[model samples]
Target: MSALDFIPELGHRVRESVPRLGAATRFLVLGLGRPFHRHFSIQQWLRQVYGFGVLSLALMVVAAFFTGMVLGFQGYYALVRFGATSALGTLVALSLLRELGPVLTALLFAGRAGSALTAEIATMKATEQLSAMEMMAVDPLAWVVAPRLWAAVFTVPILCVIFDLVGIFGGYLIAVPVLGVDSGTFWSQMQSNVSFRGDILNGLFKALCFGLVVAWIAAWQGYSAQPTAEGVGNATTRSVVAASLAVLGLDFILTALLFS
Candidate 1:
């Protein structure tokens, strides 16, 4: 294609995307508000909680375990060189609670839960299920999208907490029993160095932001996808990629604002 031809196509794509972005924002605002005013079903919310939170528990635990082991191993060696091996517990706990715990949990959520959500919604659209709901006077956005969004909002922080806990245990396993670090010192030093507000709560805050971003991108992409199998697949892919990028970018911004 000629350069001039590409210009028109690029402009067209930008114009198309702008309105969709606005619509998605509106959808999120309305979804967030509606539950407060209307009678949202507790059953639906619980179902989403199970789907988004419970279903992903095993994977989160596994990831946290391996991550903690690696941190323990590396931190032990690093601190040993400086004769500060006693600080290993503090290093592992703080590192997991403050940074890796939230970031990696979010990336995993995006890859696993976020992609599934996009695919599910897009497939529904592809099959005309969304249209059917609309024709029957049911607000699909409120019924389908809102619950998932709220679920994700709640679930991610819970998952992050779990990740931090499990990761710390894994670190302790490696540091204490395997590496011969003093068990009492491990727990004690962690308690002394890691502040609840500065590390743990801030990590949860990051998880909350990541949850919203991941859910929003997944739902919006699915809702706006073209009604076709290929479109649904593409939307799922985009949702994962976009949510991952959003998590990393937001992590940097939040760290600067909250810590710096």
Candidate 2:
């Protein structure tokens, strides 16, 4: 067959996949329904939230500390050269509270927790456990997906706090003791120049949204995975990619809406 003859066949195959695509979209919306009530299983939600939080803390702490230190050194030197050293606190607070803390935490969580969730659920599906749950009249969405989503909602903002604290300490170590910045002057400048009500609230809000996106993508992909180990691996990879992209995209939209 000539190449021209294959075009119609390709289009036919694409048309055949439309229903599956529609079904996927429907599933996503269904999961969002009654999100609050479905997510209210206190014990399960607590375990999921805290479990991911504790597991990922070490990496986040190390990353935040170094991030703060580098920004302090780099920002301080550049500002001092321009005779604008007083603005260092403003820059640090704005950068960390608005961008670095939430974005970095979400990326890290997607790589760590997102991948784990996808693999875990996908494996269960492959082993027939998910099917058994369905046969027993237990709603897998409630038993599996809701708790994770709720947990992420709780966990991610808490993680952001850890990120901000470590990052501030990193800046402290570089600016105060090392660079001879007066500790009191540095902290007071941070406090005086930063708008806590706006910056802190916005940062936490972004973190919460990021957590929901990450958890939802992970759970959705895993639960809908095909019955093969390869499918599980693909779901895990896609979960990370999709979750990270959603976090960044949502961050931009949110920043514009909130600040602009």
Return the TM-score for each candidate structure. Answer: 0.93, 0.87
Considering only N, C-alpha and C atoms within 3 Å, which residue pairs clash in candidate 2?
Answer: none
**What is each predicted model's overall lDDT from 0 to 1?**
0.92, 0.84
Candidate 1 lDDT over 49-163, as tens digits, reads 9998999999999999999999999999999999888999999999998899999999999999999999999999999999998898777877788888999999999999999
Per-candidate clashes come to: 0, 0
**Best candidate according to TM-score:** 1
lDDT of 1: 0.92
Tens digits of per-residue lDDT for model 2 on 1-260? 68698899889988987976687666656655535554346687677876789889998999999999998899899988887766676677678888999999999999999899989889989999888988987766767767787788789999998898889888878887788777777777888877876888889899999998898888878988886989999999999999999999999999998767
- Model 2: residues with Cα > 4 Å off, grouped in runs: 1-29, 32-40
Model 1 regions lying over 4 Å from their true place = 1-16, 37-39
